[model samples]
Structures are given as structure tokens and as C-alpha cells.
Target: MAPPAGPGATAAPDAAMRALSSFRRRRLAMRGAAPPAWLISLATVTIALVAWIAATQAGLVKPLFLPRPGSVIGAFSNALDGRIDGAPLLDHVLASLMRVVAAFVLAALVGIPVGLATGLNPTLRAALDPFIEFYRPLPPLAYLPLVIIWFGIGETSKILLIFLACFAPVALAARAGVSAASVDQVNAARALGASRVQVVRHVVLPAALPDILVGLRIGMGVGWTTLVAAEMVAASTGIGQMVLNASNFLRTDIVVMGILLIGALAGAFEFGMRRLERRLTPWKGKV
Candidate 1:
């Protein structure tokens, strides 16, 4: 209804939009590039370390609260040599790893099948959905006391805590993966003389594996974080206990070292899971 814009006005707006679009494209490209990922990660760690060093040297933060990097290194050395708590750090790491392995393996065995069944059967889902939904949102700390009271302060209790923390994620992930299976593929398998069980085993499971792996990763993370709370029950020889013990004495360095060790272990698990996912689900998203 109005007069047409002048060439000059249209050109300026068009140029500005083009520039913005180009900038966005470049940013996205940079993010998607693998080389930049490592570079940025390294740069981020370097910046954090430098800032921490600066803060410590400038005495902006007390050593008792946040020890220097060198102090943490020394604490790590002591832990390795069995000088801290008169136990080798590897012993603590192994103890924690054992609990995680036990809980995670059990969760996978039970949760995966239950998840797959629920995905295939609406009746089963209706029956079990409320139970999973009710507890999934609750944190480990919320139910930890009840668990300890029921099971007593023992290894069983600790493992059970970790199990509870890991179960919901793995089950939900497997179920979601099942849902993601192509209906066409399922029907084709049925038409090709595949039984219900065979169709699920061959078609649905393979299709859902990528999602199941993702759920396992999340479950592992939850289990790892729940370690601290789990070890709170009559614990003596795990990273969580080590951190808690050091905190009692204001041993900030040891606490920080323990935290780093936990982070490293968790990161290692995540990396390994990602590799396993790629290898096991080569056909992911291809269908």
C-alpha cells in the first residue's frame, strides 16, 4: 500500500542481514568442527588454572578453603603413596569402581528388559509407568535415609543406593529407544515370518541401542554422583569417604584431589560409553 523502498535503504538492510547470517553460519561451522572442540577445551582448562593460580598467589582465597594447585598435586602424590588415610588412592578408586560396576550391571540386566517390554506393551507401561515416574524425579539424598534405615549401613545398602540412582535413567532410555524403532520395519519383520519376540530382539533392540547407550551414560553419571551419599553409610575406603574425611580436617587440597579423581573416572566412563555406542550401533539413524 505504501511507496516502494529506495534501492539504498533495501541494499543496507539486505547487506546487514547477509552479514548476520554469515556470522551465524561461521559460528555454527566452528562449533561443528572437531579441531576447535579440543582447542576450546584446552583453552578453557588453561584459563581456569591460570585464574586459580592467580587467586591463590594473590591471597584472594585462603588455602584452607581452596588450596593451591601445587597443594592439590602434593595431596594426590600423598594419596598415591598411601600417606593420606594410610591407604593407597587406587584402593579407594577400586572400591568405588566395584560398587558402580555391580549396580550398573544389575540395572542393565533388569532395566533393559523391563524397558523393552513396557515399550512393546501398553498394558505393562500403564501398570509400571506410575512407579517409575513417581521416583525418577526424586534425588538420591531424598530417599537415601529411608534406604539406609531399611537395609542397614552396609555394603548392600551402598550398592542399593547406587542401583536406585542408576535404574530409572537406563529403563527410560531403553523404553524411548524402543519407541523410536520404525513401525514399518517392525511390520516388515512380522510379514517376513518373524515372531513377536524375534522382531523385538532383531529390529527394535538394534534400533534403540543408541538411545539405550545414552541412558547408560546418564545412569552412570547418577550412580557416580550418588557415591558420596552412598559412602556416607559406614564407609571407610572410597573416594567419597576420602573426600569427606579430608573435609573434617580442613584438608582442602585432599578434598579437591578426590573430587578431581572422581571427575576423571566419570569422564573416562562417559568417553568409553561414547566409543561403545559408535561401535555397537553403526546403523544408528541410517534407517
Candidate 2:
């Protein structure tokens, strides 16, 4: 067999080594080219700062109305230095975050079961559909007065407002997700002697997770929007309170800072939710 084909007869080792080297080089190149998210974020901030500076210098807007980027940064620094009342900016952020968490948890706890029941039972859905439709259309802020009256002008009222804001979206999304589940999958589970609970646990919940997460995301956004309105009622400390107070003083720098902080917080919260969704539902396609 020609001495069992000497090393010269086969270039597989050399080819394999070249292929491995090529893969490593490609990987290193990709790593070098991958843009950092922080860098993109910094670029966005720099662009906004440049725009603000240009506008201020060109006399396109009044300082009292727009303020310079430097002023906003100064306000942020002052806030950090304990120049403001009712705790620092970070405290306000944490307070708002805590309220959001409380409200979201409350909404999820109640909404999921109601949604499941409504989705599984046509009669129940028919009975509750009218009420849900009516409430879902009504803005949460519009009901703030009534909520305050019922729950008092305390944390309860604020939390309830957020809960109401979150609840509608979550319940609606859950119902939709459950209804959209594949009938074939359900039937197959049944054919395999799976009980109703088993089918729901093994098939329905998993399939509906993506939709449920979507609803959660929407609900959280709505809740954040409602936060300002809620704080406008009886809040002593929060970013919303900061914005409202700044408006009274005509401190445009603080107002702008508050607004930017709100947006940043909302974006951060949404990003976290997206990450959580990815982790929980790895089988789902990337957003």
C-alpha cells in the first residue's frame, strides 16, 4: 500500500492547521471591530451636548428657557453634592424604581391569573370583556383623583395608579398569548394523556412567554409614564417631583436634567427587561 501513504501523500495536517489559524484570525478581527455599546452611548451624549452648546451660543434659545449643557451638568453635580432636598438624585431614582417594582409585581400577581382564566373560559371572558375594554381605554391619569380619594394621598395611591397602568396591558397580552397558542400542540398534549393543568404548564405557558414578555415591556413603559402623573398628586420625593419643582422655579437646567434622567431610567429598565427575556426564553428569536 505504498508504505501506507507517507506524510507527503496527505496535506490534511497542514490544511487543518491553516483552517484553525484562519478561524482564530477571523475571531480576533471580529473582536477588534465589535463596537462597544458604551462608546455608542458616549457618542450620542457628545452629539447632544454639541447641539445644545451650538444652540445656546447662536442665541437661538434663551438660557432661562434652554440653559447650557454646562448648567445641566452643574445641576447634576450639585444634586450629587447634596444641594437638593428630599435626598439626592440617586435617592429619587431609587424611590421611583421601588414604586415601579411594587406596582409591577402587584399587576403581575393579579393580571396573570385573571388572564389565564379569561383565556381558558369563553364565558368568563364574555363576562369581563366589557369592563376590561372600558377601563383599558381610560387613561390611568384620568382616574388619579378617584384613586387618591379611595386609597388616600400616600404611597398606596401612587402604587395603585402604576398597577392600574401596568395591569391592563399585561392582562390583555396574556389573554392574547394564550389564545394564540397552537391548537395542534394542545391536542397533541391531550392525546398523550396530559391533563389540562399539564398542558397549560408544559405547552401553553412556554409558548405564551414571548407574548407575555412583550406585554410586560409595554406595561412597564405605561407605568413609567404614569409615574410623573402619580407623583404630581402627593409625592414628596421622586424624579417627577424634581421636574415639577424645577418648573415652578423656572430652572430649565434642572427640568432638562430631570427629563433626561427619566428617559435614561426608562431606557435602562427596558434594556434590563429585554435581557431578562432573552435569558428566560433563549429559544425565541433575537429582537
Candidate 3:
């Protein structure tokens, strides 16, 4: 064994550590100068609004292409009062919301089970993977004609299109997340006298919950993205239909209004899902 170091050596190392700690504190202080996320978001929004107003109000962009904020607001008011088209804004909003919610719920109800089963059984996954992979990458618009021909240009076709868009993401996410449940955990559960069903219900699901929630969020987004295409199916009262009508009439303000409304609604739903994910998976992202 070596003898202990003298005070001089210890003093040098202690000074170096103290200097490193000071450097870290200084770096943290520097980082503290950055604004909070919400504040940055607000600032970004403010800048965008200012830019939009300046571009439109100062005639940098044509009203035909990009209407002024005031024009859009007036269009919004007219929509609210049912002055733009025969139907009121509430009708359009409700129609779109109903279609999206129906499709998303159906996708979750079907896809989640299939996904779980696929994860639990390699044979099932092998059997299903080909079909899922073949169609998942196809754009919704590509099959719109086939769906219309099969289901007719009715609400059924619209919801089915949206459902197809949502189903793949949810199913794939669930399948991927199933691996998060380790073999050790499964074995442990079995050793504890847990039934197969109990092992899955208690162990697999909790571990996979985060991925499932992520899939739901992604599926919701895809459903909304397909909403416009789905609403193209002889729809008369949905927001997508309203936007189509506005475009035909060269009503740029109304088109902008519809786009903004769709974005706001989607954003609201996304925020709600994030909150739900946090609530249900409090153990997520922790050590």
C-alpha cells in the first residue's frame, strides 16, 4: 500500500474541484439568462402576428392570396352568424368533430387490441405485419376513390377514411411499445403466481401505457390531417366542405378562417391528450 498524500497534493486537488464547481455554477447562471418556454412561445406568436399584419395591411401580399387579419376576423364573424354559407360555424365544427372523434375511437378500440395481441404473439404479428405495412404508407387521398366507390360518398366513407388514417399509427405504436415490458418482469410476475392475463394486464400494460398514449396522440393527428380529404366525400356541412366552398368562390378570408379554426381545434385536442398522458403515466421519464 502507498503512503497517504501530503497536505500539498490534497490542497491542489481540492482547489481544482472548487474551481470546477465554480465553473459549473457560472455556466448555470449563464443558462438562466434564457427565457422560459412559455415566454418564448408568446414572443414567437407576437412576432408572427406582427409580421402577418405588416405583410397584409401594408399590401406586401395580395388579398387574394393572403387576406388581412381583420378580413379573416370578419369572415369568422360571418361564419358565426351563418352569413358566409347557409350553415352556421357551429354546424361545421360539430360535423368535423363528430367524424374525427368517431374514427379515432374506432381506431383505438380496434387497433389497441390488435396491437397488444400482435406484441404478445409473434405469429399474429407476422400474419398481420404485411398487410399493415402495405397500406400504412399509402396516402389517404390515394384510396379516397376506392373508399367512395365501396362505401358511397356518404358519412360512412368519410369516417372510414379517417379511421384508416388513425389505425396504422395506433397499432404500430402499440406493437413497438410491447417490447418495453422486459422478460425479467414477465418471469417475475409469473413466479409470483400471476396468471397470464394478470401478467399482461398488470405488467405489460403499465409499461406500454406511455407508447400507447403516444400512438393515440399520433393517430389523432393523422385523423385530423385526413379530415379534409374525408370531408371531400360529398360532405355539405363540415369545415372541410366550408373551406372547399370558400375556395370555389375565391373567398380567401373564409379559407384562412377555416384553416385557423381547424388548427386551433387540433391543438386543443393535442393539449388535452398531453395532459392525460402526464396524469396516467406519472412514472414515465423517471429513473
- The most accurate candidate by lDDT is 3
Please give the TM-score that candidate 1 achieves against the real structure. 0.87
Task: For candidate 2, write residues 123-237 as lDDT tens digits.
Answer: 9999988988898989877898999889999999999989999998999888888966789999999999999999998888888888888999998999888888889976778
Mind giving the per-residue lDDT tens digits that candidate 3 earns over 1-287? 99898999889999999999999999999889988999999999999999999999889999999999999999999999899889889999999999999999999999998999999999999999999999999999999999999999889999999999999999999998899999999999999999989988999988889999999999999998999899876888999989988999999999999999999999999999999999999988994
| TM-score, structure 2 vs. true | 0.82
lDDT (Cα atoms) of all candidates against the true structure: 0.92, 0.88, 0.95
The better-scoring model by TM-score among 2 and 3 is 3
Identify the superior model by lDDT, candidate 2 or candidate 3: 3
Worst 10 residues of 2 by lDDT: 1-10
For candidate 1, lDDT tens digit of each residue in 90-146?
999999999988999988998999888898899999999999999999988899899
Native RMSD of candidate 1 (Å): 5.1
Ranking by lDDT: 3, 1, 2
Runs off by more than 4 Å, candidate 3: 1-16
Q: Which has the better lDDT: candidate 1, or candidate 2?
A: 1
Order candidates by TM-score, high to low.
Answer: 3, 1, 2
Clashing pairs in 1: none
